[model samples]
Structures are given as structure tokens and as C-alpha cells.
Target chain A: MATKLARRRSKAAAFGVFNPNHVVGGRVAGLIVAFWTAIALLLWIASPWKTLPTPPEVIHALHDLWWNDGLGPELFTTLKLIFHATLITTVLALGLAYLTVVPAMRPLVQAASKLRFLGITGLVFPLTLLTGGGYALKVALLTFGMASFFVTSMAETVLEIPRSEFDHMRVLGASELLIVWEVVVRGTLDRALEVLRQNVAIGWSMITMVEGISRAEGGIGALILNENKHFRLEDVYALLLVILLVGLGIDALVGLLRAVLCPHARLGKVRR
Target chain B: MIPGASVGEVVLDVKEVGLTLEEHLILDGVTFQVKDRIREGITTGQVVALLGPSGVGKTRLLRIIAGLDAPDSGTVRGLQGEELPAGTVGVVFQDYPLLRHRTVESNLLLAGSIGGLSAARSEARTQELLKTFGMEDRAGFYPGQLSGGQKQRVAIAQQLVVPRRFLLLDEPFSGLDPAALEDVSKLICEVANLDEFNTVMIVTHDIRAAMAVSDTLYMLGRASKNGKHVPGAKIVGEYDLVDRGLAWQKGIMERPDFVALEHELRGLFRTL
Candidate 1:
């Protein structure tokens, strides 16, 4: 009987990471940071860096950049860019979602959304070919590309909304505009935010790429590109530090918004 | 379409209305009408329910009535001599789709807010609903944080926020078990008789739920087959259930009338 009891418990315990203990471990706040830190350190060590300045030197360089090279204006520019991107993406995505799910336009929206995805993907390549060598043009192209995704993912999220929620909102006698504002917008906010957050990192890289190609002036992206092109190892490390700190700050902001706008609720068990 | 039509003037008129979805005939040749008047104390209310098995279009009927869906073959007429503009038909749908992002307070504030009522006015109405529903304590909580029952409570609160007589409820009691069902049933009864404008229409297969709160009940069938550009689905029967008083349906659901009603409803069609 005791052996049977142990055997019954064995399979239950055998499942990895789904054990209750693992659930508790997963919920710990900084577990992800710890895991990523270990991986990042491993990558840093495995990759060549002797000739490159160390992390501390990079930090000092970031401070110097802030103090001497003027971090404030560039930071403001990046912030402004993101804010505009977010706003434009939100309004356009909302309209696209509403149009996409309407039963009459459901098929057309479905077809159009598919076309838009292809169109947006096509847009990305042309930006590479046409916007040949201007950082400002590249920024515009990248922002446009980012907005296209906002429309796609957001519209998809909007389209995939549980039919049940849509029906309930209608039963509540919510106007079409009201449905867009309240139901569709709220339902898609978390997902749109996730896409926004994901693309933010991508945006950073894109900026650096533009700077590398276009020789733009003064932002951290430009700083990174400038340091690397000129072979200034110290400045490269300093710029990397700037990138790291800024990335973390943006990630933290995303987390704050998630908590404020998408925190766990009882129904979160069912829908995101 | 006069601005303020009176009793028997047809708040909702469905004439030979038929609906089709993905080649499935959900409702066919369905026709019905209701007045705009809430029942009062010491009097039977103008509460109506649509009862039928799943896929029978009990909800489709409600949707047509609520103007959430336009009938493929017919038109819907609203209380003020035209179909009340969308969002004008206060409803409590089966799933209790509360805005998960909003607080219980916000969930309850929907109608009043959309009606352009003042913040203070809507707040007061929300307060009244919260107090009545015993969810005043959860006012600040998001739907994601609330239990299934709590979400339904908020949904109910949303439907009741406006002082309109018209309503469309779809399987409002199916999600709740016996005890909370009792509480919700009682609350719905109280709301139905709140003396605003009037008629309450519900769609539910649970006869006991129908008999408990409805003044009259209609039964739609599973898969109507009218066979037109739109196939046919139809309302099989309409019933008057107002004779049963508040005390009649109290604790015991196994009573003769209850059992008979259940048997009668089950006899209607397939389990859908």
C-alpha cells in the first residue's frame, strides 16, 4: 500500500516546473532578471572584450556622456518619438479593429488585414532601398514600420476578442463608438502594449542602425554608431552602458503600465 | 418613429425575421413585440424571457431584439417608435461581460455615463447599485480581480444603472449555482420591478429562472429551417408566467410547477 502511494505520487512529482514549488518560484519578482543576468554575463565573458572597456568603464562613460556629451536632449527625442508612435498606433489600430470584426466587413477586413501585413512587410524593404542614406528618413520609415505592426497586432487582437464580450457589450446597449472606446480598446490594450514594449527594444536597434548608415548626430544610437565607427573602445563601452540603462528604464516603465492598466484580476484567469 | 411612443406601441417588433450564420439557420420567421414599462411594487412586472435549448437561438432572439444583430429578413423597431439606437437597449447578457479593466464602480457606471449623466449622478447611481448588490466593498476592484459571481454582479449592476424599462437578458442564471443563483434571481426580480419605463425580455432555457423573474416567456427552437436566402428559425411558443408570486419560488425548486415547467422546456428540442 505504501509503495502504491509512493508510485501514485511519483508521476505527479515527475512533471518539471509545473510542481507547486515551481509555481511559487515563477512568481518571485526578480527571477527573470537573475536568469537573464547570468546569461548576459556568460555571453559577455565568452565574447572577446579584453581590448574593449569593461562594464564599469562603460558605466563611467555613460555618466560622462550624460555630463559632457549631453544625454538629455537625445533622451527627450527618443521619448518624443515613442510617445508619438504609441498615440498614432493606438488610434489607427482601434479603427482597424472595429472595422475588422464587423460581420459585414469581417471578410473584407480579414482580407485587408492580410494584405496590410504583406504591405507593411513590403514597406520595410523599400525603406532599406529608398531611404538609402538619411537618418531622419530612416527614423520616419522605422516609425512607420512600427505603426504598421501596431495596426496588425492590435487589429488581430481586436479581431480575436472573445465573441462573448462583444455580445455582452452590445446587450448593454453600448453605442458603436462606446464599444470602440470601452470594449475594443480595453480588450486590446495589454496586447498592444506588449507589442509596443517588444518593438521598443527593436526601435532602439533600428535607431542605431540608422545612425550607423546615416551618420546622424547626438542620440545614444548615434553615440553608439559614432564610437564603433571611430574605433574608440572607451566610448563604445560608454555608449553600451547608455543603451543598457535606457533599455532597463523603458522596461521598468512598461512594467509600471502593465501593473496600472493590466494587473491581475479574477477574470484574468479567463481572458488577458 | 415618434420620439416618445407609449404602451403596446411596440418597443420591439420582429416580423418574419430570419437569421443565418455559416449556413446554419439559427432563427427563422421569428416575430415578437413588447411594450416599454417596468413593473412596480404589489404588481406583476413586464418581464419576459425566451426559453429554449442551446443553438435554438434564444440568444439570437435577444440579440435581434436588442438590435445587436439585424435580422437578415426582418427589421427591429425600438421603443421611441424606432429601434432605440444601439446601446439604448440595457441588457444583462449570459456571460456577464464586465469591463475587466474598470473597477466595479466603473462597471456599474456605464449606462449613466454614456447617457451623459453627470459624474456625480452616475456615481450616485453606482453607489445605489453597489449597496443593493452587496458589492460596495468591491467597488474599487477590477473585474480581473473579482470572482465569476462578482463579475456577474457587476454586469447586473451595469444593466440596472439606467432607469429604462427595456431589457434583454440571455441565460443570466446558468453560470450561477443554486445559492448565488437565488441571490441573483432575487436581485433580478427587484430590478425588473424598479418602476422605470418597463418591459424586461430574457432568453433562458432554464424554466425555473424564467418562471422566477419573467412576466411572460417565449421559446425559440433549435435550428430553424425556413429555407430562403436566409433559412428559417422560429419562436415556438410564448408563455405567461406572472401568476407565480415571489413566495412561490423561494427555496424549493423541486415543486410541481417547477418540475412541470422544466419537463415542458426539456421537451422543446435538442440540448443545444
Candidate 2:
């Protein structure tokens, strides 16, 4: 039994380490992750830069921000802003994407998709002038910044749908309007959610830049910028960690919602 | 014709349908007609097979028949001799495209509703189809959760939820094991028997399986002029399996005559 077990272990190690397409077992994968994480920690600890905050300092800074500073409220403010912007962007992007089925709408959809290449900095002046430069401006800027990306992804999804799908609906005697609703609206809803998830991350990254324009709003972005201005490196690090955790939480939540609402999305994917 | 089956009015008439793509002629004057088969005061559905080599424009012709695409010349007329409208004929693509986000039951219900059934009626039909397709337990499952055969079944059931007279299947026998092949063949027959006017046109290269299930066989190939090959695909051969006493028979594939015909068709298919 001992010899058999040893042989199996050797064989697994041989395949797992060098085979091009061989997938490692769960335990081995977990070990690899732990090994890499430990190496990164060691490298960080042994860094030559004296200005870099130690792990303990970063942790203490996080605690201080949670208790002394208004991190919780600032996070809530950012979350609320993201929620509103995401809702508006979703409706606009989906509408524009679905309209591509119309011959006239194709050019407009193409124009909207191309808008992503335009820098948001160039549009901020016009956006501020239009919105009177306040909280509304920040929301407008975020929405403008994210809308093109969302539309691009969704339009591609809409286009990638095979011609057979529409034919399938038509054969069922579906009216033109019904085909749009069934194939475009409902058929791609799950993919829309996925696109939303990706765009939300992009929006989150841009929140700080947008909030910097409206410091009175007091979002996490503003807080991070203010800390950076003071040269409080540890606090900045803590704030960044907070942002990472919050973003991950939001991503996971949206993914979970997709699984619940569109459970079919995860089917046929390789599960660990 | 089969002993008790009588051919009736032409249900589908294709006249000189032709298509060209990017300076290349794909289909040249493809013409055929499908007539209703009546037996014992019931309209038993007809199964027609379209055989062709790869890239012989078989799928393009099928798309034209399904009204998903228009031919550059000629017309396809339905039962009333009117131009076939998009969605008038059902199509099952080779990949069995289903709305990935929807459950099997929802997919069927959507098709039924689009076909003009009321919500309650659609629900009732969905249930009946799920039961009939032996997918009652899997009605809650999504397309991605199904095996290839199961997905094919759901795809077929999706079309049947609506009262479609003509159905087009593209490569239904492609990529199936022996057992799965037999199962799909049986399912195709069952689909045909469900309604008298329900006609199935299968676009495939699998001669044996096509011959096993289809009552009529049409071969698409480039015609030869003066011993030289022509550029476009056209219907080169037509066989009435019913008149030949080979269609709708149990264990027919094992018979000597069937084997001989299969061998002969195999030789002909290689030339195309």
C-alpha cells in the first residue's frame, strides 16, 4: 500500500509539474497559491525602501481610518453614486445596443461605441457647464465615462448572436417587435449583467477622479486623494486596500446575482 | 408513394432560387417542391433530406427555405402560394442555438407565446412539450446544462411549441454516437408524425442517417457541362424513398437494398 501510494504521488507530480495541458489537483493548486503568497510577503518585508509602510503599519492605518476618519460614510457615498450611474448607464446602453437591429440605428450605435476612445478630461468642461459643476456633474461625468464601454460590450454581444437565433424566433411566428423583445432584450439580459459587472469595475476605478472634481461629495476617492496630498502613505495604502476589498465584494455580489437570476450562465463552464 | 400514403397539394414550392456571395456563385437555380402526404384521413408529415459535400451551399439553400435569407433570383412559396415570410418555417441550426439565460421550459414558453398563444396557453403547451420530449425533469435546466442530444431535443421541442408546418434541421446527425444517432433519428420521425402538415427538411452530409429518416433525398452538387464542372451548386439528383419502398420501415438500414442504395449514394456524394 505504501509503495502504491508513493508511485501514485510520483506519477501525479511528474504530470502536474511539466505536462503542458495537465491540470493540477485542488490540493496542489492550493499549495502553489500559498507558496507564491508567502514569497510575495517575504519580498515585501525584505524591501530596501525605508519609506514603504510595513504590514503592521498598513493594518493600523486601516483601523484608524475605520474609527477616526469617516471611511464608512465616504464608502457609502461612493456606493450610492455608483448605483445611480450604473442604473442610468444600463438603461441607455441596452437601449442603444438593441436599436442596432434597425438600419438607421446602426450608425448611431457605431458612433456611441467609438465615443469610448475620447478622453473624459476633454469632456469635463462641457459636462461641468451643462450640469452647473456640482454633484450632478460628477454623476454625469461618471455616466459619460462608462456608457461607451458598456454600449460597446453589449452591442458586440448583440451582434455576436447567430442569425439562426432570429430565424428560430421568426419560424415560431414571432412578430418583428416580438423578435426584438425576445432575442435582443430578454435573450441577452444575462450577458448584459456580465457586461455591467465589468463596467462597474471600470467605473469604480474612475470614481476617485470624478470625486476629486467634487470634493464636497466626500467619497472614498476624495478621501484617498486628500490623504495622498498630505503624504500620508500608510493611510493611502489603507484606503486603497479598502477600495480593493469593496470592489471585490461588489463584483462577487453582481456575479452571485447573475448566477441566481440567470443560472444558465455558469452551466458548461469548468468547475474547480 | 408508400402503400397507404397519398401525395396531396404542394405545401412548399421553390422555383429557380439562386444566390451569389462576393463574386462567387454559391447556389444556381435550386428548385424543388414538397407536397403533403395524407394517410387514413390524417396528414402524415414528410421528411426530406438535402445531401451535399462541404461548402456546396446546402446550408445557404436551407436558410433561403427558412426565409432567413433571400435568394438573388426566384421565389419560395408556402401552402397558399404566397411568398414565404420570415418566421413561417422553423429552423434548428447545427449548433442548436437556444437562449442560454432561459430555462428549457421558459424557452419553450417564449416560443409558444411568440407564436401567438396566450400566456396560459403557452404555459400549458410548454408543459405538454416538456412531457412529450421526455424533458419534464429538465424543464428547469438551461441549455448549457444539457448534453448535446438533450439540447437537440430542447431545440426541436422549442420549435414544436408553436404550430409550425415546415421545419428545417441543419446537420442534426453530425457529431453523434451510434446510440445518440439512433435516438435523434427516432426523435426526428416522432416530430414528423406529430402533425400531417409538419414537413422536415434536413440539410446534412450524413447519407446513411439521412436515408434512414428522410422520405425524399435531394443532392446538391455542381452540375457538369460537356464533362467539365460548373461553378455553382444545384440540385443534381432527387430520390423518392417512399416510391422505392425504403422509407418509414423498421430495420430498413439492415436490408440489402438499403445498403446498396447507401453505397451508391456514397459514391455519388464523393464526386460532389
Show where candidate 1 strays beyond 4 Å.
A1-21, A25-135, A162-174, A185-187, A216-218, A229-238, A258-272, B1-16, B20-25, B31-41, B72-85, B116-120, B212-215, B222-231, B238-252, B268-272
Give candidate 2 regions above 4 Å deviation.
Answer: A6-39, B1-5, B38-43, B80-82
Error of 2 at A66 (Å): 2.8
True contacts kept of 1: 0.65
Which whole-number lDDT from 0 to 100 does residue A49 have in model 2? 90
- How well does candidate 2 score on lDDT at residue A136? 90
B1-272, model 2: which lDDT tens digit per residue? Answer: 56787788898899999999998999999998888877775557999999998899999998888887899998999888988777778889999988877889989988876777899999999999999889999988888888999999999999888788888999999999999999999999889888888899899999999999998899999976687768889888999888888988899999998999999999988777
Model 1 root-mean-square deviation: 7.1
All DockQ scores: 0.41, 0.66
Worst 10 residues of 1 chain B by lDDT: B1-10
**DockQ for candidate 2, C-alpha atoms:** 0.66
lDDT score, candidate 1, position B201: 74
